[model samples]
Target: MSENNTRVIVITSGKGGVGKTTTTANIGVALANMGEKVALIDADIGLRNLDLALGLENRIVYDIVDVVEGRAKLRQAMIKHKQSQNLALLPAAQTRDKSAVNPAQMRQLIEEIRAEGYTYIIIDCPAGIEQGFRNATAGATEAIVVTNPEMSSVRDADRIIGLLEAQDLRNPYLIVNRLRPKMVKSQDMLAVEDVQEVLGSNVKLLGIIPEDEVIITSTNKGEPASATEGSLAGQAYRNIARRLRGEEVPFLDLEERSGFFTRLKGLFGNKK
Candidate 1:
């Protein structure tokens, strides 16, 4: 019942398709790569994709629902990652709904995992501000609110942050995902500073992930982008992981700098 040094982090988003599951998978892998013991829990219940993101879909036998129902032990339900010895995943039940597990059950499960001596546990929360979200965050010590660099995503993220604060979830950081620097320059998308302004002064901006095709390919291949060394999104996730570990890491510059041709054009008094 006593807690170890395990930090239970819930990765949530108020809206769907903002890369919450992907963020969770990568951060889990990044931490594991650093030699930290990590466990990823898919808290989405009926709709789960964290397993697929981690390439552990075929390894699932017992899920979180089974563990809560006393049908299986926690270790029996956990699937260890093939590539990382320190990384494991507790998949969600595809057939069960959010009501299948309550906050108390989730808290107890987290405690059991912590007692098992895991260093970090990342809970991949279901999208929307509903029962699934509540259940996902109940046992969390910290939170990572994932959002895209858009008006709707930012609005939902703000609402989610307020909800997290109401639940006494301290220091919930923000991750602006799927950002397009060219779009921002063309005045077609929201800038990072614009999002920061909308989220207000209290929220902390953790990191930003640029729109990269490599992420899409990685997801399709059931591999987390963070495990890929040359990926920009992977580098961003690794930086976020380092920041989460209390290390001072610089934010990734996703903006496209002016090239030689563009600067040459500007020198000719023709700025485009």
Candidate 2:
């Protein structure tokens, strides 16, 4: 791919435990599965986990820090995905802190990867708005903010969107992860529209990933859920990848499997 066709996207969430890393892994894999050349960068520094998420931990001989420090070449630091030849991962240094690299170095690194002809470069940003976040967003042409359905996550996401806009990264897409339809039906969780209302209208809803056990199981096996079959969350990530490719794919209907009214009726009937 030419430099003009390359998209450098940063996946970020202001709060931790919001599936930002997982989103990066799955989305990279999903895009690669669709025949797009993808490069994933773990910009978390000391908290690096993208390598493990992609099951390339054991194969990592060099990391991003090594490349920036002039100890390793970019190609030497990148570990290719086992399943998809088009996918690769450039891991962070577990021994180093966020201050180890600067925004300029990150931009240079991304340019090197772009020169390698990658169609998409996905950066898994560290949680919080710190130097790590700045380093991750330095060369990103696009951004994806990952958040949950809770108030805390939404509030943090709003802040992140503002930060991105301040950096001239406007109209960042939103991905609401770990949504529970049953809880939403019982008025316990925020609905998609409710979350969007709090975030205002500019942030477009890219995808809605229902809470799935397969995510945990797949991660435990060091494999991303999107690379597996028969998983709702996996399919959701795939659909998001297609949408990223400019395809007009519809969002998944999360409540179709178990009707909320039927479950409510069953609960009341059992109480009699």
Candidate 3:
């Protein structure tokens, strides 16, 4: 369709447990908090969990399926976030499978959301490059591929990036989630440079999110970490949102926090 003021971004990961849903929720929350009208779509359908991640599971009366089937209007299906008035969610149906909606329908639904004047529409794509992936990416003007700092995750991300490029989608940015600086420092895990080397030079690095307890606690509490201050993972997500808004922001110093404590200990002659 025609390009407009709104930008539809599909957050995808070829492999599961790479934090695509979490990234979508936090980025939406961050953008909304910045006064941008943002819409988050759960495109996982029967396996939908974006609502739970954003603490809006109980608030979903209607979903994207309802709107697609003409059972509910777009406005009626969107659930506004309690954390930010500018952020809303268009949840997926819990009972319906991925095949329940097709690519064209997804494109139309996203177009409708964009027409409603949202500055950003982020779609949480299901894991793997299948029907769900196709449906989730139908209307995407941009793509954010989330991956962990490992061989399998990076391999899958490269595959997904190839798919997006084949479909002529915009250059997909990479978000390396769950990176542990200690492991990398100990040479027990793949470093960020290694991941970039394997993924190729054309791929753009968006942001890196460190492994943090706040993410787990926030997930359990059904609250997005982005709305919680002093959360390292949340701050990393907010940085990604700012970068997406075309602002110059540095990639997070994943080792800074730990190193700071080490330096303080040495200053007091308590080095271990």
Candidate 4:
């Protein structure tokens, strides 16, 4: 396949526990559901968890390091999803550290996978700006900065955006995960606009995933929220997949569901 035919995207965050891995899993599954062949690479190395998130940990016989070090073929290390045949995972080697593979090797591995004809290659970058981050972004043609609706997360996301720009990955998209609408309405949390403002005008808002307990449950069950119905976070992820496919999808209305009078009072103010 031609290089233009495939999109290599790295999902990253400068801070940890911002739902970056979960976003990677759901986006991969969502794109696969849309009939696009997707390859997910867990680039965290020793601290790998994308396998567990995808529920394919037990099936991972070989990993990326195995492929990189010539111990296994690319296809041999790839673990195909049982439910979504279009989606496959190249898990990082838990026994190895980030030093096990370098940036050039990562680029080569991504190209090898690209030749396999996958439309989308999603790289789940390890948290922080370290060797792991460098390896993950080295092969990426695009980037998505995942963050939470908080001051620290936004600050870290801004730093990451700068790093991506420095690496020539311009116009990176943003996914504000774990946003609590009630908190936003109550002025306790930063709104999506606030995050965008902090990240600057260059970073575009890709999607907003409302805080949902279903995401935690789904991750624990080894099923991505995007694959399940009736999940707001899942719907948000699916929308992001659609957007990635060049479809214009409106952002989900994250306003808390409330009684008619309450909603009316929210829209209009309380009468003096």
Candidate 5:
């Protein structure tokens, strides 16, 4: 391996609809924005969506399956992101099933990519405990567990964390997504503190992404929200990027409507 080989990291969510793919896409861009060479692999197989999230769906001539099957070289399968010169994507084969590739093959492919001099290689794992998930996490040096602040999401995250530990993939971090502080205050949602208590383990908080309509619009438009500076979700992903780079960043206060003291402090500061 070269001195600048890639570091493989997996972004996984134990349950569906927890913004795993979205996180993967944005983090790839965020890392690249920091001048680190980053690559994203969509290990979702038949349900591939990372390409669409990165807006590289139409440019994929080869996929991960083709590279493993000797039909295409790894470079041929990698599609560079349009906006980020340092970011790239290795899409999943829409024509292939999860069984077409195995964990060992996935590891081999990642190793090859690592030798090619990328700094960060992120794999977007398929949802659920199946062969696809195994293939996705085959060679993860580190992992990011994405979960919403809810019981079902937390339960699924626990299952995934258990599986990772069983496989000796320790110290995976957590990113609390779509957190609504007002809802949590009203007893309608789970707060980050509550989530940490239930998981029964210490996980470094990355960033908190709020439920934003702009995120949905960006996804529908096939553009990552991280591309926009005005987006709260985009800011959250950027903070995660900084955290990934070992920088200390403060978490965002998601709840609106400040306390009387806080409001008074803001008012006084404005007057000064």
Candidate 6:
């Protein structure tokens, strides 16, 4: 198969439960909402949750495995979201393992999936450095590595960056998830800059996802946090989508700025 003019991206995390799938779903929805043809593929295989997070789990009749095996056509595996007209899902098969498919198979699948006019193809990869990860990044035009603001998570993200760099996935972007400005200011937790201090040199800072309860609540409700009104994290993801499209959106308010009162205090020799 031949490639199209579509941008295929892989959403990956070195560690588990670091919001890779959530990022995949939200960013996919945000892009589709912006009138782009998007398709979210569950490349996690057996342990797939991309469909559930997207609230289209029950709608899956075919999967990536099914497509590779030719049990059904590629179109038959895609489940369109009733809410987002341009957004469709290619779920993972629970009955299959990661070994069921390979990188070539994935490349072929995405090439065909893009034929349906999908402008953006986002693959939700499985955790760990295995064949699943290899297949997730087979022919990606770019990569978005997601990690939380923590030592363990950051460490894993660094390892992931190393692998991607070795693969030469140029211009891969990083998204610092669950950032808590208060904890960072108090020196209790890692800040967005801290994570960037480690991995940002290699990967561009795509966006910062703050630690918000709205994300959890929306996930349980089978809705993307970005869809909720005044959702900070949701808005952040939407901005990320726009940025991905080469749009220039202002930076979000992740940290509190120096107010007039704070500046006055500093000028009066009462800094802090």
TM-score of each: 0.92, 0.94, 0.93, 0.93, 0.92, 0.91
Better of 1 and 6 by TM-score: 1
- Give the lDDT of residue 132 in candidate 3: 92
Where model 6 places Cα greater than 4 Å from the true spot, the runs are: 1-3, 256-272
Judging by lDDT, tell me the better candidate of 1 and 4: 4
TM-score of 1: 0.92
lDDT tens readout by residue for model 2, 1-272: 66779999999989999999889999999999989999999999999899888888899899999999999999999999999899999999999999888999999999999999999999999999988889889999899999999989899999999999988899999999999988998999999999999899989899999998888988888889988656778888988998999999888777874465654443354320
The residue-by-residue lDDT of candidate 6 on 1-272, one tens digit each, is 23366899999888999999999999999999988899999999899898888899888898889899999898899999978989999999998899888989988888788787789999998999988889888868799999998988889988888888776786689998988877888999987877888775768899998888888888997889865445668878988998999988776766642345543443364211
Please write out the lDDT profile of model 3 over residues 117-166, one tens digit for every residue.
89899999999899999999998988998999988888899899999998
lDDT of each: 0.88, 0.91, 0.87, 0.90, 0.85, 0.85
Candidate 6 versus the native: TM-score? Answer: 0.91
Question: Which TM-score value belongs to model 4?
Answer: 0.93
Clashing residue pairs in candidate 5 (N, C-alpha, C atoms within 3 angstroms): none
Q: Flag clash pairs in model 2.
A: none
Measured by TM-score, the strongest candidate is 2
Question: Which residues of candidate 4, in runs, are more than 4 Å off?
Answer: 1-3, 256-272
Q: For model 5, what is the error of residue 47's alpha carbon versus the real structure, in angstroms, after optimal superposition? A: 0.8
| Candidate that beats the other on lDDT, 2 or 5, i.e. the better one | 2
Ordered from best to worst TM-score, the candidate numbers read 2, 4, 3, 1, 5, 6
Off by over 4 Å in 1: 1-3, 256-272
For every candidate in turn, the CA RMSD to the true structure comes to: 5.9, 5.8, 4.6, 5.5, 4.1, 6.3
The residue-level lDDT of candidate 5 at 132 comes to 85
Clashes of 2: 0
Question: What clash count goes with each model?
Answer: 0, 0, 0, 0, 0, 0
Model 5 agreement with the true structure over 1-272: per-residue lDDT tens digits: 36345678888889999999999988888889888888899999998999988888889999999999999999988998888989989999997888988989988888888877889999999999889888889988888899999889999999998888776778788999988767888988888888888987756567788877777888888788876665667777888998898888877555642355654443354320
lDDT accuracy of residue 246 in candidate 3 = 95
Q: Give the per-residue lDDT digits (tens) of candidate 1, residues 1-272.
A: 23567889999889999999999999999999988999999999999899999999999999999999999999999999999889999999999898999999999999899988899989999988998889999999889899998878888998999999988986688899998888888989998889988888777888889887878899899889888676678888989988988989877656532355543443364211
